[model samples]
Target: MQPAMRSLSPLTPSDYHAHGVCCCGTPLLQHFHERMMALFAGLHGPETVSASPRGQDSPLLLTNLRLFDGSGAPLRDNVAVRVMEGRIQAILPGDAEPEGAEMIDCGGRVLMPGLIDAHWHTTLAAITQAAAMTADVGYVHLVAAREAERTLMRGVTSVRDVGGPAFALKRAIDEGIVAGPRIFPAGAMISQTSGHGDFRMRHEVPRGATTPLTEQERQGVAAIADGEAEVLRRTREQLMLGASQVKLMAGGGVASTYDPLDSTQFTERELRAGVQAADDWGTYVMVHVYTPRGIQRALRAGVRSIEHGQLADEESVRMMAGEGAWWSLQPFLQDEDSNLYPDAARRESQRQVAEGTVRAYEMAQRFNVNTAWGTDILFNPQNTPNQLRHLAKLTRFYDPLTALAMATGRNGELLSLSGPRNPYPGTLGRIEPGALADLLVVDGDPSQNLDFLADPARHMRLIMKSGRIHKDRL
Candidate 1:
């Protein structure tokens, strides 16, 4: 179904220049309107897309606001944050409001760094039929723009995308032609035959003869290999495709029908070869591990992080720490409109996902494991609509501020982002000077009352990312 697009004038002169799409002037905006209309049709029904007032359309000053920097700390009230040139200039007490700066009174709302999604999949058209997309490059780029902006609307300004559908989505975001999070993409995930990511396979061949291999199937995925050389080669292949890091099917998963959760697919030699490939390129390798053997092997192989570690006990967790490994945990919280997975396999997958999350949480808390936070949603696009549901984990068990840190500063550290003093403008996750102005302002105090975390659409009144106003309810 085609989407409905609105034909409207540019909200501001700067918005026209900011897009860098059409040539300057009213005629250009008309062409832009037509292009956007075409983009809307590609995304689906017009209802899925929205045009937030751009550039000067968003008010500048957010005065008299309460703020939380996503660190576990006390909230500051009557504070003001100044954003200019896509970077945070200053953060000061309430009295520091700038004059003639389009003052937007935040009314004691709690402001924070814009949310980040640690692990996500936006490249696939549908998770089950993902392989079909290997044949499409143009359509994939067309869809990624809508997928990313949808993530932005959910208040996500950054993401660490674990592999799927290659690097097309990441390129679209970085090139400034689309709207989405600051994407750190791990291009393609490496997996052995019958491993977690090798979910399906097909071939076309002459009649009455053995099926012939299609080029797409060989290059797109199913990068199964048993030897160290092959593993190293495949890892390099992904890096060459513009991956920021590397992802491996370290073990089985609930999503892959072919792989068993506890079975180890790659040998220690092959795993280490993959890690060596990433390290040579100055990138980190993360593993999809749900069992002890996979976890142990990843640690032995010198991979940097582990995900979905359902079977990690005291021994496994300690080994990771000794090896300087990080863990990415998602708090699915089990009961948040989980009915979104109505199919039997998906429902079963949901159960496994929930169990894995809880187990991951318990291990992190008990062992004080070096960990980061993320919502491993987005496999289903519908899940994006209720993205705030994952925040309920903060309110229910952990404190909200700690939850926020897992989403923000901690992720920056995991991604190895440098401090404010770095020579080439490193990413600072805090609200201090030199931090990227990726911030969120809410209507209520989130520290004492965590439920404010759940209702993002209502409570988050202002959303700023790198000095850009994606959403403003002030």
Candidate 2:
């Protein structure tokens, strides 16, 4: 069952690093070659034991487990889940065993929906800031591929990528060429000149009408647009590039050097342009803004999601509640997971955001705003392992069950805002029949001991995404 062979040239590690395994330096073909080679060797070959069946279309039965359906419902016992064709087929009683199905005894563990990150930067999170700006885009994507595999191992099966050039990575994951979470990509973060998404040097200012786009912009990392027309064009370009949603910068950011934290970036007219473009394509716009003025302006222009509104005043929170907008909050507390900034100005801004995070959670709770959780870990490979710790930090504001539910069901709600542009289709973030098969079976009851999430390697007994088991310790 092998193909024709040829005398292949030998390559060194540095050759592999510089030119990649396939040498063309494209993630798709590189990953595809690796995956196909593995398959040709009998799915992990004669050396290691493959955990579970690689065929996603096969039927899978999980038995003897307590269920946290991610629906904010009470835990149920004595039930088994049936998965078929990458979707939940039924929730049967414990004694009902179907014929000709692969079964895994859960050993009385707890099964819950896999975690969903509402605000994530796929291609930008794991690499250092310096490397991301200067490294080869192909090399950057290879790093992202590794990070994406780690992300799945953390029990996160899906993410709403708010910014970054994640389209190619998404395609690789979808094609089974790589092991990663489902990505709902917003191709780029659109911003005006000197705004938050502008990662240009100070000497590169004074962009004339004929100035060429920066390297970042050319790579679909971020787009710098000035007026309404340009904003409209950029928004459509992202959609044309298979963006599930559009992300626009509406305020200053802590990471950017030129803009102050309180300065609003986009005007209402410009914001309206992006929103309308996304709306025409049956998707919504999510904006990056922190201050009240910026948040209110984005809401006035029909933005559906508000990202990082920690510094928002009570009035702005009220407006978000009135408009029924999704509040995508992240654990930005000045902790070990916080990004390191050398300058005092950025450090001061980080401190202010940390202080506002507590009050922002309180306001969202008080006003009944739809809140979702994420770990906006950027450019820090050392802190990337703290992704689950960020979710566990939600317990500081809510109980264990509530915090887990926020990462599962609540975040799933926010991702569904991308109406027809939803890439994976079917219901997600739930354990009922007809939902996508993304479940995690852990050692203990997370309802009582949320610490199980802090160490997924030893605690997670089994991990399944789209009816295919990626890891199995049972």
Candidate 3:
């Protein structure tokens, strides 16, 4: 006699939360539950279908494609990829057929690992700094949700948010409440009083005054800590809230009003406190620093990554290389779309950093330092759409292939520095078997013509993150 077929019921919120933790203790159940919900909603088209009822394991096969693989090696033609259970299962010959898999013909398109942004700020999505400062907290997050979706559609599948209150947004995207990139949130930036992260109005008194904290501080976007004990406390708070890494303001910044670009912030002891706290949590500390002295100080304090070291000298670059620290440099062009600060001093500071970009890249190459790329798009919703264009700017210093690798494999290596605190494990930034299936299919070869990357909506044929198809033009 034939056995009766069993039907499964829809998953409830409580059921999802109960099974949300992965065997590795990663928070992945929510993502699995959401994929199941997407299958039930009939949102995915025939070209992209959920392979299983549980939605955690899906089999997808793409054939007849040119593969870049994100390895910085030569491109291979007529390649095929098999993704199962949210990871790459094999790199097969193009003509080989796989069993029990939904197949998609790539039409000889270019398949590569998805792009990654090493430095991003999810909470600061306003068109201007003033606007970001004045916008309602709830409204800002709403804008962030839209921005995150747009970012993913543009071919970037993951980001390391160096600053902002991104814990909530990260949870939302991870749980499948929204469609967006995977986030490695740094939580609020730990800053010294009157430092780069401080965004208080001119008339407002400093900390310890009768007045309360600034709106940004109150919203957990940035925290001002004065001494070693306070810095340790603030850093621990972010780790407790699930930050994969810690961010500190080791030097002044262009956007900040009170500090000049050349000034260094935070004492050595205070910076060490943050590093120690992050180390205790099985992660590392990345600092926002630019000048040579600032970089040296941060290196001495055990910082593992240096953001925006455009003004660092040769010695500092050598020190960074010797310490095996990551240089998360931004490609700041002096074009019209560049940051236009209203304050004259701030504008000059921005210009100074822009002027140092070429020299920084040169120094990085001279010392053979490990460098990564990021858009560093903040407080400018209008410019956010041009994020990929910033990657093209790297061609000024490197070939198309090398520049693409900087944004992919090199950036992926830096993201893994979080060690045991890394949220989404497995390999990233490459298209090898066993790597996470965050990938893109482009209409043209980005290795030869990077112009296609500037407009992903027009040239990107398919976008997949963790075996789930987000966009499929083919």
Candidate 4:
């Protein structure tokens, strides 16, 4: 389903100048300004040596390594990879050297494809809920900018951003004005009133015909719509905003305030409206849902991915497999990596999700479903460092190799559902010829011991995205 190519580049004013017209107050000018602000937002960090920019024309080689190609196969020794123009050119013998290439010695470390976070919130991961709701938009973007660099240093080279105002962040990273993972952005989360994405408080209920959108909605964190027409409009708006895929809230959520855990959201017709909108744009819809009824409704409406289906039953899981849907699961074990709750109801909801987490994984495996892994860390900066720890937690249900593959290759496969909207147009999530060069050199083999991933600051010796070295301590 590959469609015509689309540009991820920020808009320039050449058209206006060519036509002898002023570019003030134009969408292109606004977008250009957003990119500039995103670049300036990242200026708070301490000065350090930066790597020279490498584009499609750069020739680089990584040699002397044990390789885990992220294909779920056993590790291989004495292999080297040649990368040029930001993609893997060839896999050669460890001792083979080519002329006119910048070589990086791996020193017998483990070289593997860089990690991919299937369900991430680029603008919402690090900030607290209170800060996110009350802080200035520019301040929020600045915090997200610093977190983006930290996320890359954690060895996550790409992320499927399910929701938030990540368009500017993605543009800045793509332009090389800021350092971050390659972002496949789902512009905003669309939700019905009182649905999972709704952030309205008790006092703001009984919305009028012309009531203004909530603050969170205005910031692109979520969009609240009702009925088929409204849902279709909201879905198309996200697609028009450069969303690779669209996210809709099909059920209740723990982080949200009003919705109960058992509530089923978005009627079949409402969801179908969203599905039709995304499908027309050559992409698909992914929904945040966790109940049997919600899952069934979404699947019936042709949703391609189900996120956070921890509370699903066997029937729901079987239906998911039969429909060939992707299960984007997370390790919500209610331990160090989970977000803390202040109220009793939310805590009870957390316990239920934790209790169902392992069973959900087991069911997906039993049904042979297309399962992927992610760390849905939101509004918890302290737990964000435990992102890799969540991947390690997957070892409870699968072996180390299987767990690693879920985050690398399997997650990459799920991200490709964006089709034409895919910003970085190339193969990802595997160490093979013709794939994008997003890789990591680990101090130890994660295939044998997944614990190496839990401490990226110590074990991640080298990190590369698009064949350019982002962190090299080798």
Candidate 5:
């Protein structure tokens, strides 16, 4: 009745070689000897080789390392970490041997939590504004993928894209279709008319006029909203499209053409509308603001994150601390070669922001406010490669370990303000029994020599994210 039960044939050496498979259907490289014998037998005499014993699917053990757990604690020597199912399983003594686990000897290296970029932009992968405006969408995504891979390779395991079309990129990385850092994407930035995110050219007419939406707007890179209703609608649209948080332009910026650096962009009511929409979705709003007025308005509107408080005074910093909000500041120094602006007005705005960096950090310290660090490297693909260098610049205001912790633990805390909207739901920026396994193994102690982070390819010996090894020079 079953038509002879369809007797299955055993895999011959030729079959194994053809399918590039080995014992237990593992990849040929995982069972290399069997593959070599199969290939040789196909060419030479009938010499049969037995398959090697298969190891169990066990946890990964990283041994003989110095640990910096990102908790502002002193480094511990001779540490061992075990990772299972993409999460940290246990932390044991380095000398204790584990059974049935894949072991990697860290060679007495410094092991720490991977870096996090609290503010990043995925769509601006091109080096110049003109190139970004003229490049094809598909080509821009290709560049973004390459940049993302580079960012991961440089020891940054996660990033929060403050503004861009990053939803698709985040999905692709999560599905393992691409190799990159974990992304918390904020969909298109909500901007009021003539706001910081408004990228309209000088001669172009306003939206709903004779002209249509620009390429950037149509691509969901930025959305312009005028009134409170429009702001609410736009905010909700971003939330519906899987934004972990909402980004609103509450003040002017150096990169925009229309808005001045001193002027506030959105009204209190408009900002409150965006905040209300984000709150309804169980997330919070982050605003791109610099001045005290902008910061005060956003604080009153329930915004949880304040980006670029470089221009804010001591009062604004104290208010931010009192309100228990986050200060996501970038170390924009005047001597940095990357902060070059295209026009006189933009250059002046950048100078002002750069000059205020020291005071901002001092005020934040004085108030004991929650602070996070990011590169905010925009419109310069060449500068994107220097993300770690930007982190290192924080040593001007903080010690090496404090700077590292700010980029790691403190940034993770800010990202968690999204609440239930957090895409990756686990403790990050720390190495413990329960945190997600995103870590880096470096050749030297970065706390002693911050320059070690400047050259990741040479100094970073191992890179792991989600329990998967991405770079293992060791």
Candidate 6:
């Protein structure tokens, strides 16, 4: 066990985040334009960033295609859609193609919103064939590009990256230096000296294998904050670093070797500080928690969401409802051969993470908490060839449509996107007039059946995001 270190920089709540309560409240959001002007240089580049510029139109249109509209609706065939400035400009019915618009026939396939994986690890990479057991910092960059390609090939148009050290890969992917989905990334996670992400030597680890989270690894992730002062500062730094949200270590995790599952690392004050910082920065904070003891403490502190709510009991679910907390309940799809790791403890922990995920989802649904789709897939596809297969197990609990909704519309809502962030209202995950032009043409109807999504390479007939054809037969 790692000895807990005392925090040196103590801070009171009143002095935190320019003094508490968050100036960026829901009501103050009406001043969105002014705030954007003031914060534009910081939010991203100096110029306001949007999907596309004005007036540029789609090069072609689709006609005679069966479309699903991303609403889990019955299919409509022989329709045409026009795109301009990366937004849907028109939708035509009765198989009518727009004049002078290059057209393609769909052969009666299903069209739906580009799937969003709410909680993917954007930085983790695949190990090479020769270095299966090697653990080094160099692997991080390599894994990021590999995973990005895999995700895009799977037809995922967007993803919310929960945690990664430094979040450098996320910026690279976003800058178009790498090919991947649009990423919403959280930088290095906030942790304490002896908390979940901290990987300092725990009583001299056995030879050959070092500590699960090394001090250098701490440099990338493992923001070790102590007391209210440092904790709040760390969270704010993450937000300033372009983190869409902040992730804190609220409890023990399977990835950490020293911490036990029941141990609660963050105090109420620290958690509250984290939340306050995110709120002040116009985003939210999500805590990595499992056991009820730790999750209960987080709920009391009023964080926005919970990640990997494994070991969460019925009471924890009720607490979520009482606090109106959102859940990133990633129901793990199980893989039979995931236990092939040589380290027995590591293998067991991975299995427990999967089981805990399923358990958490079941309880969250029972308590009626607002849940979003999250697929926290960490294992490399090479090692676990069933990477995509495992995710299928997650849908076992929900009807196919509900599962799709959790990943799409609900996920968009969690980001505060559609209405205020977006130029239009009720626009995403639907194909109504003025809705987004994110559509995927699949080989079959996913509303009536979902197995087709399991193998996107074989199933995704075409992928069109913002009317640009990223992948298509035409």
The best candidate by lDDT is 4
Give candidate 5 misplaced runs (Cα > 4 Å).
Answer: 1-57, 209-211
Q: Model 3: how far is 436 from its true place, Å?
A: 0.5
Clash pairs, candidate 3, are: none
Of the two candidates 1 and 4, the one with more favorable TM-score, higher being better, is 4
Rank the models by lDDT, top first: 4, 2, 3, 5, 1, 6
**Tens digits of per-residue lDDT for model 5 on 3-93?**
1111123434554354444456656564675555443322222221112111112477888899988876778987798888788888898
Evaluate residue 172 in candidate 5 and report its C-alpha lDDT on the 0 to 100 scale.
Answer: 69
* Number of backbone collisions per candidate: 4, 0, 0, 1, 0, 5
Which stretches of candidate 1 lie above 4 Å from their native place?
1-61, 97-102, 125-137, 202-222, 332-353, 417-425
Candidates in order have lDDT scores of 0.66, 0.85, 0.82, 0.85, 0.81, 0.63
**What lDDT is obtained when candidate 1 is compared to the true structure?**
0.66
| Local accuracy of candidate 1 as per-residue lDDT tens digits, 237-298 | 87777677788888876555656556787888889999888887777788888788889988
- Give the distance in Å from residue 385's predicted Cα in candidate 4 to where it truly belongs: 1.6
Better of 5 and 6 by lDDT: 5
Tens digits of lDDT, candidate 2, 1-474: 221121223322222233335676588877776654443222322111224443276677788899999976778999999889888999999876656566777899999999999888888999998898889887898888878878888899999998999999999889766678999999989999889999888778788879888999999889999999999999999999999999999999888788899999888999999999999999999999999999999999999999999999999999999999999998788987788889999999999999999999999999999999988888888977878989888888887888898999888888888899999887888999899999999887767758888888788877889987777677
TM-score of 4: 0.90
Which residue window of length 10 is worst by lDDT in model 5? 47-56
RMSD (CA, Å), candidate 5 to true, equals: 9.5
TM-score of decoy 6? 0.76
Query: TM-score of each candidate?
Result: 0.82, 0.90, 0.88, 0.90, 0.87, 0.76
Comparison by TM-score, 1 against 2, better one:
2
True-structure lDDT of candidate 5: 0.81
* Per-residue alpha-carbon lDDT of candidate 3 for residues 59-140, written as tens digits (9 for 90 to 100): 7788889889887887898678998888999999887665767777788888889999999887675346766677777767
Please report the TM-score between candidate 3 and the true structure: 0.88
On residues 1-474, what C-alpha lDDT tens digit does candidate 6 reach at each position? 221221112222122112223466664653553443223112222121222222136334555577666554556676776655556667787455356555555666666677776777666534432342345555545656656755665667677777675366656555544445667777777888777877556564442333354554454555777899989888877776677778899988665667766678889998999988877766777888888888889988878788877778888889998888888876553465343456677667767777777777777778889787766655455532333454455558776667776666667666552122121233555665666666777776555557776676677776666665545542
Residues forming the 10-long window of minimal summed lDDT in candidate 2: 40-49
